[model samples]
Target: MLLRLPTSVSETQEYLTQGAVPIGGATLVWATWQRDGFPEHAMSLRDLPEANTIEPETLGAAVVLNRIDDRVPEVLRRAASTVGTGAVRRTATVGGNIVGSTLRCLLPAALVLDARAVILEPEGVTETDLAEVVAKRQLLLSLRWNTPITSNYVKAAAEPGGPSPLVVAAALHAVAGGGTLLRVAVRSEDEVFSETAAYHGDAGETLSTLWDGSLGRLPVPARELVGRQVTELLARPGGR
Candidate 1:
């Protein structure tokens, strides 16, 4: 397959005029080709300068997405690294994680961190709150956040060979009041994709539930674990 790459969207469109196919991530490109037809020609944004850097003003010195590896914060980098196997990581952009319009485990930490999404559409660049973007499907260009918080990721998948998330959660400490923020995102594929939130005084039990739920061993609902229900249950000592 021939690849007609561009550093700018304008350049990509130019190639399209020349009968080239357009793509962002190669995986998406390949998927489109397999599901549809040979792109005739393909355009990729890999050469763009915008895809490389992460700005701190946006996210309280959040780590750059490309550099999101073991060297970065454990929770954030682990989320990035664990997105898929090694090959997928090598080519997949951070924006791809959020744009798929599915519930993801990594993004909740950013929501808790008060992150914003930096989108560069054909119109121009615009920023929107993460929550707003999650409410619908929009092509995303970049992601931004504004907090320095401890974060964690949890997931529950089926058996030994499934791609679906039975349940997933990402927890973050809030920057404002030193409180804990818990974001639980779930995807039942054709069923639903939703995010629920709660504040935690002590996140230990919530974390336990998230960790276990990701592994399909959860006994508590995400709302209860992150909400007041856990506290009420604990108050009774031997309560469910």
Candidate 2:
């Protein structure tokens, strides 16, 4: 029932492709029948203890987690709730989503926050922007960064799974002491898997738009919507 494969998501993908139903982080499919008709081959992410943490040195931006209870940001933790169901979030790993490209709720926030991932390849350990890593094929060992901006996440769920609000958006600004540096990221599953960014020089407009969009009623382009939402966040009167 217990089988510990290589820690890499790609290697694990191979097993899944061969009809191995994964029971580890980010995936908890229950297979009625295995490829070889075995009861189960429980894959363990815990076996690879090295793949842990969001890497605090990368601070204020990188919020990685193996379980939903780990030290990730509140926005990200709330984002995880938008995934499939409680069972899925319970087993899903942020690293698995980053490397495997499954549930992507956390990515827009990470990308908007300028988060990067630290990967462990056969060659060696290296760092890459999270967007690029998601674009390419690589084994994500850990994600490292800091989340240093007041931000918001927006997504609209439809009634009975309708067509609107397959959209998601995120906004982030640098921390105080010249926090005008802003990054707004948007994603629409209805559209292609492209993450668009809007880097506005003024934090005021950025925060304003971000808050408005996150709490807004319309489905706007990820870029423009994120901009509006972020603008609102920054424009708030009390040093928001």
Candidate 3:
């Protein structure tokens, strides 16, 4: 197998056109390889400095998961923390977490935040909605989002710090009419894909409608439990 190290996005794009696959941290790449041998050519983004930095509104695709804990909003930080143990986080890249698996906690957080992705393609760079970018399987350059008024992430997992079977993330923004706009995203094990929904009204009403409309498909008891958890989270002072 040939591993190509590209130090810049342009170089990465060039290599990609030559049938090279871009890999960050290689967590998912290695797993796929374990199941179905290595590819003929692999491009590693580890040496690309531009892909590893975190800014106020942008997070580089190659940034390690652990690096985001304190640097980003609380919802995303909390989601990042649950991705795995410290060792796993140290080697997992934000890009990989976003694109590698939709089941991860970060995807819901990103969805609620209305994050967009900077994608690098052979043609050039293009910006697109995070969800759409993931659906297209585009090579991610970075993720960008504006800070929300408040946000919260809640996950239901089989074990402490284990991969979550269900994740719910909500972000709120104060509207001009003394009401709050709420965006919620839910990911569950039983579903083939995750979904995000939005509502605007009194917190209680919004939360109720969100639960009833988006999570209604879930069993009644399970839906009630998730609804309560999200309600309590948003009800906290300052959404702490």
Candidate 4:
């Protein structure tokens, strides 16, 4: 396998145009390579300092998951912590988690936070919603979003600290009309439900509906447990 380390964004883009798979932390790529065989060419983003910085409202694509857990909002920090253990978080990049698989713990938090991805294209750099970027399979440069007033993330898995069957993230913010704006996103292996709504005071019912819709197909007992977890998260004072 041929590996090319690019120090600049333009160089990375050039290598990508030549069909080199972009490698950040390589946690997912390496796993896939073990089964599918390594690709003919790969571009490493580790040397690109520009893609490794974590700012208040932006996270570079190459930033490690550990850094995100340390520096981002509570909801994202919780999600990042759930990605894997310390060893895995040390090697997993934010970009890798975002683009690697739909089951990533961070994606639901990102969705509820309304994060946008900065993409580096052959033509130029562009900013777009995370969902749009995922749909188009664009090359991500960074992620940007404003912090919400309160946010929480929860994951329900089959085993302790195992991969989750359901992940939920919710954020609450003050709206212009003296109401609270609640954004919730739920993700499972087969479906994703992301919605934002305004509520006068309490948002319990709306949140319950969203949770039911997202996990309705699961077994009754499993769905009930998820519902209880969501309720506990929403009931926490100061959004925990």
Of candidate 3, the 10-residue stretch with the lowest lDDT total is 192-201
C-alpha lDDT (0 to 100) for residue 136 of candidate 2:
76
Off by over 4 Å in 3: 159-164, 175-179, 190-201, 237-240
True-vs-predicted CA distance for residue 9, candidate 2, Å: 14
TM-score of each: 0.62, 0.64, 0.86, 0.84
Q: Which sequence of candidate numbers ranks them by lDDT, best first?
A: 4, 3, 2, 1
Between candidates 2 and 3, the lDDT winner: 3
Tell me the tens digit of each residue's lDDT in model 1 across 1-240: 788656765664466557664344554446656887785566555665555554542321112234565433344565666566667666656655555524354564455445677655455557887666656644455566544444444444455555555433343434365554555444343222333334455445554555555423333454443334324422332221
Query: Which candidate comes out best when scored by TM-score?
Result: 3
For candidate 4, what is the TM-score? Answer: 0.84
Judged by whole-model lDDT over C-alpha atoms, candidate 3 comes out at: 0.74
- Pairs that collide in candidate 1 are 21-41, 21-42, 59-145, 155-214, 156-214
Residues 81-138 of candidate 4 have per-residue lDDT tens digits of 8887799899988788887665666787888788889888888778888988777767
User: Root-mean-square deviation of each candidate, in angstroms?
Assistant: 7.3, 6.5, 3.1, 3.0
Q: What order do candidates take by TM-score, descending?
A: 3, 4, 2, 1
Candidate 3 local lDDT, 115-180, one digit each (tens) = 889888889888998867777777888888888777887766576545446777777755566655
- Each candidate: what lDDT? 0.49, 0.52, 0.74, 0.74
- Model 2's lDDT to the true fold? 0.52
In angstroms, the error of model 4 at 220 is: 5.0
lDDT of 2 by residue, 17-72 (tens): 55443333625234433444544554444445456544333321112332543255
What ranges in model 1 sit over 4 Å off?
A: 1-4, 8-22, 40-42, 55-67, 70-73, 101-105, 131-137, 160-163, 175-240
On TM-score, the stronger of 1 and 4 is: 4
